[model samples]
Target: MPLGQRPGDKSDARYCGVEVLDFPAGEDLPAVLNHSLASAFDFILVPLVDPNYRPAPGSVLPVSASDLILGPAQWSNHVVGKISEWIDLDSEDERLRLDSELTLKQEIAWASHVSLQACVLPAPRRSFCGNYARVVNQILQGLTNMHLWLRLPLEKSEPMDDDLDKIKNNSHTSEIVDSWELWNSFRLLCDHSSQLCVALDILSTLPSINSLARWFGEPVRAAILQTEAFLTNAKGYPCLSKRHQSLLTGFFKHSVQVIISGRSNHNVFPVSEGVLSGDESYAEDSRVRHALTPYLEYIAYLYRKMDPLPEQERIEINYRDFLQSPLQPLMDNLEAQTYETFEKDVVKYTQYRRAVAKALVDRVADDAVSTTRTVLMVVGAGRGPLVRASLQAAEETGRKLKVYAVEKILTLLLLFIV
Candidate 1:
């Protein structure tokens, strides 16, 4: 009952509500059709590139030449002969004769004229190719128009002088007149004026602005103030309208916020309202840590500077405290292990040592061996697990022992030493 597949071998059943099957090359058409019927399939979606699939000779015939012109017509002809016939012409001359006889330039002009005519018409619609040609023509025409406008002088010509006077006399109308004059002058200059000389003149005038500013600084400032006043009062100007003005103000405020905050609204902040309240699902504490890392280093630098101790004393104290920390026992344990045991045990010891080594290097110089010895004292000599391990390492390595046991509980210290 699925589309395109017949129900059974019975002629009546095959004809009754079933659709016809489409087969490709190398496929056993009868077998495929039979399989589809047995499976109750109305249609099979097969690719044109499949080895078993070939469309019938005229199955894909296009309605017109426009459709046939885009793709591989030769391969298309082999698959669909009707399309080939529709597109086939005796010669290029015949094809050209069938179409308009305009050259490329004339065709462009004609197309633009057609589009301009269409634009003026009510609900004008064109075929796809016609639309494409019209669009190309419209663009070319726009460029041509612009070039023509640019050819005129910046100052008003004879016919435009009346409009210019009307604009200058009425302050309210000046902007519109100025804009129109500028645009028309630009167009005329582009089309008829010597552009190279105009460009050179423009380049030469850049230094004049600075020279004028130097000579008449107050005049420049006054002119700027007057321009601002004009813009504020320009009723017809889109940017001076209340809504647009508010929108621009909002945009400027947002831009300032983005600059000060170091991120735009779209970027995630390190500490946001939702994150602070634990309501944000994707808040990463690591990002906060990353943002604060430089600040943390700065704090540490300030703390060091403000410390009461002399530099030498601070170095000694830091080194002694670090070396005598719990890290010593861990290092001794790592050094005592066999190669196989070391592989397993050394990782933890190495991590601890590296951390301590980095801290020492940052706080004290590399030649501070006295501080290392002080660290050994701070770790203590009592027979705790750490102390016992250190003793065992000393026995194995035949190294001299120096240790200090600091325990608040007298009983535990006594038991440890014993």
Candidate 2:
């Protein structure tokens, strides 16, 4: 039950004490094998060959050809060093150099055989352990037969098959098998299996079905069905409980429906008559409704969750009051003469006001240069003619004036401003 124990470790009942093997340097190792055996008390605890270590020719044992094929190249020197130390090796650099050379030649031969054998083997059989082991051992045997070793100590008494058989029949046995199957099938279903593993691993760690669905893929529904079948038939293994299985299945089914609905071209208003009428029955079908329900519910849930924030209200202003505000009174006082004239001579008011405004403009412009002026005004200005005249006069006189002008008759003033 301890983590890192090999799958076969629990099968034996006779508790043979653990042994630690040491490979010493500079003694003809093969000649000194008897001494090593004697030290083991006839129970040899062979150390795992550090994958980095290259074994002596005679020490090599036969292994599956497929297993012997070099795996992915390890680019890290630190990892190579650790492996070297574990195998009682001299240096990682030396081992790596030798491995690279040997692997190139061995891989070519392995590849040729693998290609030929692949053609002969059935798809399912190619995935089987027996076939895989045969291919793996061929490459390993070619490299060095000494890589294989028994890790467990040998029993002084003869081993019995019955106890081993009983252990093989235990509840955890199929779990061990399933783990192996899952690991071996990994590359074949990389996209799907990896995604499923990530989703399940995350769910195991965080227990959130909703978050898990975010990463679940298109094949999730099919995978869940397959997983359910495996759990049902997998005797003696602690697979997912029925309740968990049902929940996972329901979740995947719901997710699939949600995705389908999201990708569907259902519209509130169909552009063409044929478009809406073509699949009316399909749209109203019970199956379609069932599939879309979860998606609709989820959307509604999100909408409800976001409906409580405060909203801004725009302030409304009245133009009539704005025109008569405090700023307007100052403007009106500056143009009081124009207002007084307009109220008096209503008929000839426009022409008389134009002349008065022009004169006022001239006076303001002349005075602008004589003082640091704060305000300049043109009174009795008709249609703002005096304002234009004042600006022209100020330009010619080389003076800076802050000009404000008023025109008699509201219509004329509006026209002038526009």
Q: How far is candidate 1 from the true structure (C-alpha RMSD, Å)?
A: 34.5
Off by over 4 Å in 2: 1-22, 28-40, 45-137, 140-418
List residue ranges in candidate 1 displaced over 4 A: 1-375, 380-383
Q: In candidate 2, what are the lDDT values of residues 1-418, reduced to their tens digit?
A: 0111222222111111111223222222222222322222111121213233454555542212222232222111000100122221112366644453443333334334322211011112212333233333343445321121101110112225765576677733321222223333532433222112111111111223453344333222111111112221233322344444444444432222111111112332222221112222232221223212222333223323332322110011112112342435334444546444334433354554455446545655654666644356766455555565556554555555577776555665675568
Report the lDDT tens digits of candidate 1 across residue range 1-418.
Answer: 3112212211111111111112222323223223323333322221122222222434431121222322343222111110011111112455432322222223223323322111111111111133323332344455332110011111212325776778778744533322223333333433423211110001101222233223121100000000111122233321123332332222221211000001112222233322211232424333342221222222223223332444434334323312233434433432323323323444454454454445444544446533443233435323344444544444443344454566443455766556
Quantify all predictions' global Cα lDDT against the true fold. 0.26, 0.30
Best candidate (score: lDDT): 2
- What does candidate 2 score on TM? 0.16
TM-score versus the correct structure, for each prediction: 0.13, 0.16
